[model samples]
Target: GRQGSRSVPQIIDDWGDYGAGVGQVAASRMAYRYAWSTTLDLE
Candidate 1:
């Protein structure tokens, strides 16, 4: 479902790098969207 056995901080650290490599605003928006969608789907 998610990534490896990393904590939330670790995950966000990776996300920051990935986001920076891509596009900061876009990557952050997408990450938030994905997180919200996943939570809604789970519910």
Candidate 2:
């Protein structure tokens, strides 16, 4: 599954509002890393 065009905010928004729990924080970190990696690959 390639989501290379999505920004971090867009990814988070897609996940919907799940409140700020530990899992949400971890997921955000993972999404941020995924987005960063995808951006690097695009370059």
- Per-residue lDDT of model 2, residues 1-43, tens digit only: 4755767897797666655566789999999999999999999
Which regions of candidate 1 are displaced past 4 Å? 1-22
- Give the Cα-based TM-score of candidate 2 against the true structure: 0.53
lDDT score of residue 41 within candidate 2: 100
RMSD of each: 14.8, 17.1
Best candidate, lDDT: 1
Clashing pairs in 2: none
* Minimal lDDT window, size 10, model 1: 1-10
Which candidate number maximizes TM-score? Answer: 2
Estimate the lDDT of model 1: 0.88
